[model samples]
Structure formats: structure tokens, C-alpha cells
Target chain A: MDEAAVSSLAARLADAGITRLGRSLAVRHVDAGSCGGCEISLAGAVALRAGLTRYGITLVDDPREADVLLITGVVTTTMADAVTRTLGAMAPPRFVVAVGDCAVDGGVFKGAPTVLGGAERIVPVDLLIAGCPPSPGRIIAGLVALLEANAAPVAAARRSSRIEPHA
Target chain B: MNPALDVAIASAAPPGTAVMLDAATWRSLAAGDARLGFVGLFVSGGRVHALFTDGSAPLLLATELIANAYPSIATGFPQAAWFERLAFDQTGATAEGATDRRPAIAQGAAGTDAAWPRFIETAGEGFYQIGAGPVAGRIASPVHRRFSMGRFSMGRFSMGCFSTDDTRILRLEHRLGYAHRGIAGLMRGKSPRVAARFAARIAGDATVAHAVAFARAAEAASGAVAPPRAVALRAIMVAVERMTADLAALAAAVAAAGDARFATLLGQAREQSAVALGEAFGHRLMMDIVVPGGLALDLRGDAVASLLAALDRASLVVRAFAWGRVRRDLGPAAGIAQARARSIRALAASVRADLAVVPEGIIAAALPAGTGTALGAAESARGMVYHWIDLLDGQIRDCVAIDPSARLLPALEAGVVGLDPQAAAVLIACYGLSVGAIDG
Candidate 1:
């Protein structure tokens, strides 16, 4: 919660060859609102015997079990609550990666009345995957970068001030 | 022009003609006509128009309601359910006496206040509800699924959240509209050419089909026809798009069944088609390629040769996969499994049929300025996509792009129920319905 904790978090993230959580990183993807293109590329990357699993990354269904939250599409107002709930459900040392142009900043649908812009509008994003729908290769690279950046450390240090436990 | 007639004489304009009708007569015809396919319902020019076709007919019928309030055709037709919901969402036109009147696409405070479908507590013993995502797994479109479960088995299902009484059997509920981008409003006031881009974006997977349908609608409204060469080229695009979509669907089905090798091959084939199309056209998705009256780009020189080469290569690879084996692998585990296989065969046959047409001539033609309502249709990977456009003084007054999702969703729900959870998941993957495509 203090400046020292923030600095330590940044230092831990910047270091290479260090596993932050000391375990396999489990990711859960939440599609706020997308045209379904990004998921195609994501599927390609994470299919059986593909890149994600080779790196010890697991695609999970529940948010509570995940270490990283991969959020896609523009965060529609209807999905705002779901997004918040998913983000909140993640255990400490969790990361949120905004995938696609829509998730980062709403892309082509930014100003639509139904859209609330991007994933950042609802929750803090640790990394942003850029593209109308980022190619599988690019998505894999972004995930690697976020993993190397130690999302867990920042997540762990910010737990006290960043998220309030539900009463 | 006969108010009482079910069939209207279509105008010779490129777009199909409209039939004006009193509200009472229109509702009756729409409900009573068993042969008619409910294309879409929309509000334009202070009247609600329902698009319908018997499939055997050459013309698409537009039955206009004289009053804002009309009886719900879905009550009788069943297929008109989502179309009516869309009409209400788009124009605030009410479908009187409709069974389900929940807003289809509108979300947040501007429309429905509750983002989640309000679950009604069924007074049944030992049944609990499980909810699935607005943000589901890897797929991009946001849709919610709620299932009433009895221990290990699944009960009734709902999509987009409506209450049901039966709590003992497996029923599915789908909550779509989380992917709403206001595409209808985005098309408003734009030129036919400009609006075509929005149509293309309606579903990235079905970009070419949407674009062609929009282009045809524009051409029809403007009294112009795409040249033979353009039509041939457009057919090629449609065939290639269908191949890619089928490959993707097959890949997803194969993957769900845990066949990594075939899944990867199908995925590669899907990507190959996209790459081939991108090399031929400008965009990978081929968005904005088909413009009003003609195509935005012509296939020429090396582009055509290389594209042809890719198509041939893809065709050989597709055939080598042995689609029959894929269907056999699916067995009866997945309900839509056979349907998906049948789709691939039908698509392949169509593609082969299209390839016989040599494309060489004037790619585009000049479209004349005109004013009229017209209907256009293109066979997409899923089903027939229809576009109805009303033009006034060369400007689009009202337009509707009807994707196949609305008609297919109920069938998907029915297919999903009673299947084991694993099988249901596979079927869902195979169907590949985009919520945005349905609700946009």
C-alpha cells in the first residue's frame, strides 16, 4: 500500500527469469463485448498442444481460480457488473490483460451509447493487447510480456488499497 | 397494391418491391402464411414493415403495418420472434400480444435496467440455477447462459434470460445483447457506400455475405444490377467465405472432441482461406470490398492467378480431410454434429459449382439514381442473409440487414438441451452463432 511496496512491485515485475507466483499461471478470459474475431485468434494460440499450455498457462472457466484475467471487447454497460465481479473474484496476485482494440479503448465501437468504452473503465488493466483482433502470435507475445512483467507482484502489493473486500 | 392479398406483384426495380397493407391484414397474412420465411421486421417511414418470402417465390414480400401497434406474428409463425424483438428494439414499435416482449439488443440504463435476466424462483424441489457468461471462454461475442440443474443433469435452458416454469428437464437460456454496438443506428443517414461498411462489420466472420447483401440491396433500391463478372466474383467470395467458416466450425468441433491434429489442420485451412482472400482482396475479413452497384476492388493481373492457385490448394486440402470421417467421429454425441457435416458437404458442392463459372468481364456497372424499396439476399455460411433497403432521392431512408442467427438460435437451444454437457458444448462450438450477428 506504500511507495516502497509499489517500487518493489515494479522491480519484481521488471526482473526476468523469475516466476512471480511460484506456480503455473492460470488465465480466465472474459469477453465484455466483442465481434468474436479476437476469440478466433485466441483459440488458435491456446488450442491443444499450442503455445499457451506449452508455457504452463491454463485457460480456466472460473475467475476465482485464475491468476490472470484476459478481458476482450468493449466493456458494455450490461457487462460492466460481470466484469467487476470477475475482476473482484480473482485471488490476490492477479492480473488483468485487456485484449483487442475494443478492450483497450473500445476500438471502432468506442462512442456507442451502449458501450462504456474499454475494460479499463471498469477495472485496472495490467497489459493491453492491441489489434482490431490481435493475431494469435501477437496475443501470445502480449501474454508472455505480462507474465514476465510479474503481474502477481503488483497484484499482491495492491491488494490492501486496490480492492476492498465485499462486506 | 391490394391490401387484402398475401402476395404482392413485385416492381421491376433491382430491389424487390413493397406491398402496402392495413395493420390488420398484414398481421393476419404474416401469421397465417405457413410457407413464408420471416426475413426481418423493421420500422421505416412511420410504418412497420415485415419482410417475408416463400423460398419458391422470386420476390421478397414487404408487408407494411398501417399502424404502429400490430399483433405479434411470432405467436403463430414462431420464426418472427426475434425479428419482432428487433423491431421493437430498433423503432420502439410494439408487438401487441407477444409472448416474450423483452428488449432484444438494447442494454444498460438507456434500455433495460437489469443487465442480467431476472431469474424467477420456480417453486420446485432440488433444482438450482447455474449462470454462464456475458464473457464466455475464448469466443469474442458476449452471451449469458443460465441452466436450471437437478444435481448432475441439466434442466431447461434460456438464452438472453426469460423465465420458464419447467424445472425438471434440461432447458437452455441464452442472454445475448452484451455485444450490442448499435450497428443499426451507425448506418443511419450514411450513404449506401458508407453504410455498406457497417453491414460488413455486423459479423466479421460473415463480412463478404453481409457486404454482398447490402450491395445487392443498394443496387436493387437504385435500379442497378451488378455486372455478370461482378456477380461471378461475388459468388467466388461467397464460396471461399463459406469454406473458411465451415473449416472453422469443423475445427472447433474437432477440438472439442479432443482431436488435436485434425483440429489444427482445419484451423490451418480456415486461416488459409482468409489469407487467400486477403491476398486477392485488400482486407483479410474482406470488409468494405463490396460497394453499392459494384465491388470496391477488381480482381486482376497476378491477384487473380495467385488467388486461384490458393483456392485450388485449399480445395485439395479440404477434400483430403475426409469430411465423412469427421462426421463419423462426431457420431450422435453432438446434436448439430450431423448438421455441421451436412453443411460442409453442401458448402463444398456449392463451391465446386461456383468454380465452374469463369470470371472475366466488366467488374462493376454504373448505378442509376432512383427511389424505391428493394430486397436483396446472399447465402452466407450459416443461411440466407437478406437485406432490405428503402431509398429516397439516392439516399438510404431505411435499411435492414438480416443475419441468420435469429432464426437459428431457437434451433440451437433445442439441439443443446438433453445432450450431455460435453456434447452440448461441442454442438455450441459447431453452431458458432455470434450474438452480435443476431442482436446487432
Candidate 2:
């Protein structure tokens, strides 16, 4: 809310080397068939609120540029390929980050024959975040944590998701 | 009256193709002074734009009117088919003459009363009917569902993935999933957080769009405003999602056209964007970045600097491509084979009455035929999305959401109405529909 807080946030992120300059990351966003609710939240992060571009990190249009695949919603039978094809397009050193519980583990769409939960069933997920669609701040926190883990020494473990298995 | 309005009214004609209705006449014809049948009469720059209004209550009756009149609107708007189908799915309404009755979502066993994608012309069972095999199930691999009505079959390879027999070439037709998740039923009694994830199920890319809209709805009711910082962050997130999806759509087009090099480049672009998303926002897709009345996070200072830096890098990337060459110039431009970009406003307003449902990005819409409450929208990526949320004492009584993908699937079948199947798929992709958006 205040300029001073924003300034400090920037300093801290830079100290962590999370800006676009030092980071070479790729993102692949998947829609697991959400109600557009999570997307709207994501929209706020990009459009109305925190601009990811200012961080020097941006969303790669092509899968090849993606270092991370951002997944959302509950995976559906229909969308499976689009997700796979998107992943297939990416190069190595890719990370799949399941943003919501649906992608992490199929939320409501889980168990349904038509519903496919968690993006992992399609590709290997590097990280998983909690919440229906985590708050933009939470989303950023999750991403920052991933970046931090990715930035850590090879031996350092990444942030494992806290979501429980499908009920 | 503004001269532009008059000019738009006078010129209310589509270039190259004969517009079905003139702007002024259309406004007058569609005028529901009471905002009863439909409210806003939005037309952009001579072209008939989109219309919107605050719908009334007792939606079932209003929904029924639109259902019965969908086919008629199709005669004029052609796009209303999707809306009609959506109306049917959300409220059990239907267009009297609408051929397709494929249910988008259902409560009981899948396909018991499942609606077809849009009715296709078939005498008996001769028509190609592709049933999306269960992606997961006790009897079958439900997650790897396939669609095979006859000789045509669609399959999934892995984690909710779709795959086809290598030998089987692509053919365009109305496809259906053997399984349907009763998401609405699930959200029926859950708290917002429990039901919040279901919103993402509406459409993947539009997850933020829908969430923000819902949050705005909640916020509006609560009379709260998001922090400026949060709003800024959300906007950037949305742009990233849009750009990522746009690139994917472009890549899909290139791949469809057998342009591997361009496709690869576009794919790379999408990945690059995704990676940026992951690094900046804790989640790559940035889902759930919004909260009711404010953003879930703050993106300022270094994030801004970093974002600006990335934009600078992207400038090089965006400029690297010869858009003129890659863009096939379709959708109005497609007809001329010229590169004429459709503004978001135009694209947003492209809602057709004949459409079985509304395309995505519609936060709220007025019901057709001056009926009750009906809100429509298209999520960020998965395609056009429609939502009709009913609140009783400020509690969600019923919420109906339809991803553009579902609406587009039927349209895709219709798209092949008089064109090459392959070409149509690419063209349809431009409208922005991802299967996840449909199923979600």
C-alpha cells in the first residue's frame, strides 16, 4: 500500500536474484477446466495488480521458451492433449508448477471419468501450490519459493506441495 | 446523440461480407427498454458490437425463453447456438429448433441424459459420432478417455491427455466426453474457498478472469476495493496469460499448417512466458492471484523492474517474428487473406445470438428475449465462458458457468459447415478454445 513497502519488496526480490535478468525460466500454463475463477485471479496478478513483467520475468508464448509450466483448473479428458502437446513443445530443464489444487490434484473434477486431476498425470510437476487458486500474493510467494528452490544448490530440495491425496 | 453513434448506426455494415442487420436497425430491433429481454446494445465502429444488461431474477423462465428462441437467433446471429446450449446446460433451457442438445455438465451418471455437442445431421447412426472414452474409471481408463462413435476415435495418452491413432488423420466433427464432472453440484454447498477451485475449472486461462469477476461481484456486494498494488499485479498476470495463450494458438495454427519451424518458435515463446510466470508469481500460471476485494499478493519495486526488463527482452522476441507472414489473416481478415487484427473489443463483442452459448470475457450479460438473470463471459485461455450466478440473500443459490471451448466445439462442427476441415480447425483455434476450458 505504501511506496516504502514496495521499494523494500523490490530490494528483497533483487537480493534473491528473482528478477528477469538473472532468471532464465520458462512457463507453460495449463487450464484443467476451471470456472475462470482462478484465471480471473491470475488475471489480477498480471493485468490489474502485480505486473510480472516488472520483475524481468515474463510468460513465454511458446512452450520452448518455458522453463516452468504453470497449470490451473481440473484436467479434463478433452484438454489432455492440449496440455501434453504444450509440454511436448517445451525443451528440457522444464518445471511444471500446478497452481491450484485442481492441477496439483484434480479438485472437483477428480474421480469423475471425464475429470483428470493434477497436471502430473500428463507431465512431471516440479512444484505444487495450495488453494483453489492461491492469492496473487500467495501465487507469487509460491513462484518465488520455486525460484528460490530452483536457484538453490543442486542438492537443495524444492518446495513440495502440502495438498493431501485425493479423497 | 454522438455523431459516432449515428455514423455507426448508418454504416452498421460489415466490410466485405453483407452484415445480417444494420447497427441502428439492430439496436432498435433488439431494444429491450426495460432491460427485460436483453440490455446493452453495444456496437463498435460500424460493426455491430456486443450487448449487455443487468438481468432480473426468476431466471428459469427467462432462460426458457432464450432456450426456445436460440435457433431463431441462430438464423440471425449464428453465434447464438453456443449460448442456447449453455442456457440449456445451466438452466435446462433449450432453443426450440436447436439441433445440438449435448449437455455440457450433468449430475447423474455420465451420458444418462448427457446433451450432445450440437445436433449434427445424421439419419439413424450413419453420422460420425465420437464418444470421448472415459479418462478414468473402474471399467475403463477414465483419465485417458477417447471419443469413437464409429470409425472415428479420440484418445488420451497420459494425465488427462488426448491422443489419436497415428494412422487416423484428423477429421472435424462434434465430439463428446463419456464422462462429465458435476462441478456445479459439488459447488452447491461448499464455502467460497471450497468452491473457489471450481471457478478455475471453468476455463484454465480465464481462471483469473472468472475469479476477478467473481471477486468483483463479491467486492461490489461488500463495497470493498482491491489494493492498487494488487490490481496492478492482476493486470500483468492476465496479460501474461493472454500472451501465453495467444502464442499457443499461433503455434497450434503453425503446426496445423505444417510449419514446424514457426510452430517451434511459437511454442518456445509460450514456454518463455510460462517460465517468466513461474519465476515472478510463485505459481507459473498465477492462478488464484485475486481475492474478493483485493489481490492475493503485491508485485511492485524489483518485480516491476524485473518485469520491465523482461518486457525489454520480449520486445526483441516479439519483433523477431514476421507477424505479417505467420498470421493467416482470417476471421474477417481470413476472408480477405489480409492481416487485419480484430481488436479485443470486437472479439469480445463477437457474441452471436444463434450461438449455443456466449463466448468468453463476458463478465455479465443480459438475457435474450428480455428474460431473467443471465450472465456470460469468456475466460482468459480456454475460450469463451458463460456464467449466470444466482444469489439469494447474497448467497450463491445457483451459478452456471460455460467455457468457450464447449461453446466452440459445437461451432467448430458448424465451422466445417462449408469449409475445409483442416483450415477450419486452425481458424477455430484463433477464437481461443482449449479442451480444458470446456471440460472445466
Candidate 3:
């Protein structure tokens, strides 16, 4: 698919109340000890040609302002607390997305003394994108899926809130 | 052999074969020779080994440690400072008389205190300190920098903020090892093929280069020769990897200099090249393609054509970016950007040349079962990457992958002195310092 088509599709999904925080999603990327391959792919995913920003998805540097915590790599012991602190700093209704095989289950680095398994070992991961280093297309698709999965909770909360006054 | 050094050849193989030398002789040689450049230092099997290259071939010098300590070589070779610290951290072997005997990788471990790495204090009037990162702005590998600032200058730009009295950076010190993943420990007891995966991931950006180097090291240790076609393909992969890395570095430099349009153009070109590489080699970074004996898999049927086309497009984009359009006062970043542009152009041409001459033969050769020690070197995008492998019955007994970032870190510490914080950040990006590779 073309860049325009991908952006339009993501926008359409966002407009359907995919996130609790309206149409836009702010993502904070955490490199909890990675090989840096995922960071390169993530850069490509958000590059000008990819046009992910047009879909109201943007990368933020601060965790407090982020709606999604996108983490890459196995959570090293040195970074495990940092990852927890970053997640703790974020506001409620935040989703944690594990971006690579290493973050998913520590991949090849599993059982190494320095690593603390995966992202789930420190913070609860809402979504898992699997690849040694996932492709840019796959990463984008995973984000879209995260948004879609998030919509169900928002819809259920809306329904319950609307029925509360009558009940 | 230099006749001035007392060394006995333990094994007669390649030039990089480990030669046994006493601690006294090793110290004397390091102190005497100005021509020999210290490449790396590692501790294995109760001995400290130092690798040196005298311009043409590498020389591996080994010495038995006395009381878990060796005489300091860092006094002669400043680059050996970090390596000595790392060796101490990995093993308890200390470099006695070394000036900076601080922990390198161990400080980044779980039990280490926050106040472990004590930065040199510059206490005086108008002298202050500013600490940046373990987490930086945008996507970056984690590393902390403690900048000692002194001598304030009025009305200077620092990280997009105008300061009333911006302090000149007197010194810049880096605290690395935040990305340590126990890569050397992970490779222990594994076959070269399995260990190759660890080497490939040491620094993801230099995966192809690292993999090729590790493969060559394993081949040398096992007495196996890659077929002609595999050798040709390896050269092509290295050129492509270099081209991609150069493009990324150039884009970063341009972005730092506020040329967003040109940076975006370079990014687009890099993305196109990555796509072509992914289609051709099954990974965008081309990881795991180069194994111990040879390539794990041959190139795709039409890889050459697709890659050539992508290179042509990349070259066009690079050539079209007007050099004169860039601002001259972008400090160090501008100079590095121009250099990267030239490097990218040359790498593209080299890739084209390499792709045009891929030979026809088997893609891999079976490595013979034996015990041997050898050093393999490959020119990465940053600099020379060396892998020292000791194989025992086809298993990696002792292995050390020395990344160029180890050397670059010291150079970066030296280069950033007297520059503004903003310029230092740009210089760091342009240097392409990989903390993961260094820690590994």
C-alpha cells in the first residue's frame, strides 16, 4: 500500500474512537537495552515518507505526555527500573506496546544474566509485535491494531456511562 | 617481530596468532613502540591479551597476569584506557598503575550505586556541571554525559533555548555501558553459528559487518575457506551496509543543522535502500546472512538488479542535494555532514562495482572440526571491528568482539572539549557511537 493509503486508513481507525484520548496518539519510545535494529525500523515507520504523523500518531520524548509506551529490546537489569519508572510516570489509561522479539520474550537474549526477560517482566505490555526486529510496515500495522483493540474499552465505558443516569 | 621486544611464538599460523610474552616484556614493548597502535585488550584463561596492529598486520601479544593484575599499557596508549577498564569489569584482572581505574561496564549493572561513576569535579567560580541523558531526545541509544562548564559567554544558543550567559564546556565525560547485554557470556559454549547471532546483534546498525567479521574469525579458527561467490557476496553486503549507515549519519547531521528538507530527502533515500535490502537479503539490516563458513543463504535471483537500481536512486538523491544550500556556520556538524555525503557517494559506487562482478560457486563451505585461535577484522561503517575467537572442538571457547565504538568513545571524549553542548550533541550523532557494541 502507498503512504497516503496507510495514513488514511489509520486516520479512519483513529476517528472511530480508537483511543481514549481522542484522535491523536502520543507515543514514547523506550530503548531498554536493544540491538538498535528496532529503533532504525521505528525511525523508518515515522519518517516523512511513511507519513505516520498524518494519522495523528506522533513520537514524544516524555512519558507523561504519551498515550502509548512503545518499548524495544530485552529489559536489561540496569534499565528494568528505568522502564518501570517511565511506566509509573505515565498517566492512567496508557497502553504499553512491546516492539520486537526481544521485548516480547527476550528472544535470543533470554536467560542471559544481564537481562530481566522482556518488557512484561517490568511493565505490563498491552500489545506484542513479533520479529527479530519487526519491519516498519509490521510496526505500523501493530500500532493500528493497538488502536483498534483500545477502542473496545472506550466503547464499553461510553455505554456504561450513558446507562448510569437511567439506572 | 620487532627485535627490541622479547616474545616467543606459541603458535605458527596467521599474523594475528597469540605470541606468549612475559608481563615485563609486554609492558616494555607497549612503552617502547610508538608505531604500534593498540587495538583491543581482553582477559581469557588467566592471561591478559593485547592486540596491536603495526599498520599492515595485527600482532596478538599475551602475558600471564601476576596477582590478577598487569602493568598498565594505557600510559603509553591512551586508547587502551577504556579497554583496560572493561577487562577489569569483565574479569577481576586489574591494570595496575592505570590512571583511571574506574568501573566501565560493571557500574551499569543492577547492584551498582547511582554515585558509582564519579565525574571529575571542576570546582571554582563560574564552573558548573550539566548532565544529559541515559535517555536523550528522540530515538537514541542510552548513554549519560556529564559536561563540566566554565567561562560564561553571553547570548548563545543551547539545545533550542537562549541563555543569558551560556557557559563554555570545559570538559565532556561519557558514562557508557547502559546497554550491556552480556553478549560475550551469551556466546560461551555455543557453536560459531549460534554465537554468530549474538555477534550480529552486538550493534544492530553494523550487523552485516559484525557478522562478516565473526564469520571470518570462525573460518580462520576452523581452517575453512569461503567459496569465491560467498566472498564476492560478502563484499557487496559490506558496501551496502556502509552506504546505508552513511546515509543515516548524513541525515542526522543535516537534521542537527536545521536543514529539515534535505534531511527528509536523505531519510527517504535510506528507506528506499533498506526496502531493497530487505527484499534482497530477507532483512532490512541484512542480519544473520553471513555465517561462520560463508553466507547462510545465497542472494535472491534478481538481488543485483534491484540493489543496483536502488543505489542509482540513492546516488541521484545525494547528488541533487545542493551542498552550497547548507549553512556554513553549523559548527562541527556541517563538516561531518559533507564528509558523510562524500562517503555515501563512494560507497554507492563501490556497491555498484561489487554487484557487477559476483562469481558463480557454492555459497558456503563446511568448517573443519579442530581447535585453533585467530583474529578476524572487518571495516565497519564507523571503523575497524575485530573479533578474536578461540574454538575448541567447534565450540566457541573464548571470544571477544572489539567494536570500533570502544576507540570512538575516547576520541569523542577528547573531541567535545571546548564545544558548546548543542555542537557536542551533533558531534556525537555524527560520530555514530554505539553503546551496545562497546559494552558488548
Q: Top TM-score: which candidate number?
A: 3
Ranking by DockQ: 3, 1, 2
Which 10-residue span in candidate 3 chain A carries the lowest summed lDDT? A1-10
Instruction: Give the per-residue lDDT of model 3 (tens digit) for B161-192.
Output: 53545567888887876788999999989899
Against the hidden reference, what TM-scores do the models get?
0.82, 0.52, 0.90
lDDT of 1 by residue, B164-228 (tens): 43233266777777777777777766678778877887787787888898888888778798888
Model 1 DockQ, alpha carbons vs. true complex: 0.33
Residue B418, candidate 1: how far off, in angstroms? 2.9
Give the residue spans of candidate 2 off by over 4 A: A1-105, A108-167, B1-77, B93-172, B177-179, B191-194, B313-315, B323-388, B402-411
Over B1-440, each residue of candidate 2 has an lDDT whose tens digit, in order, gives: 34433343345322211124333333342222333232111111222223322242211111113223322244334454455554455455445555545554433354233334443444333234333322211011112222222222344433243333222212345343322456655655444334556665545556666665555444433334555555555555555555556555555555555665655555554545544565666555666656555555444234433444444433344456565665543332143121112222122223111121312231222211111222434335543334544443445555555455554554455444434334554565455554444433
* Candidate lDDT values, in order: 0.70, 0.47, 0.81
Model 3 lDDT at residue A27: 89
Best by lDDT: 3
Query: In model 1, where do residues sit more than 4 Å from their true spots?
Result: A1-25, A47-51, A55-58, A148-167, B1-15, B57-67, B108-121, B150-169, B300-336, B342-370
* Stretch of 10 with least lDDT, candidate 1 chain B: B160-169
Model 1 misses residue B187 by how many Å? 0.9
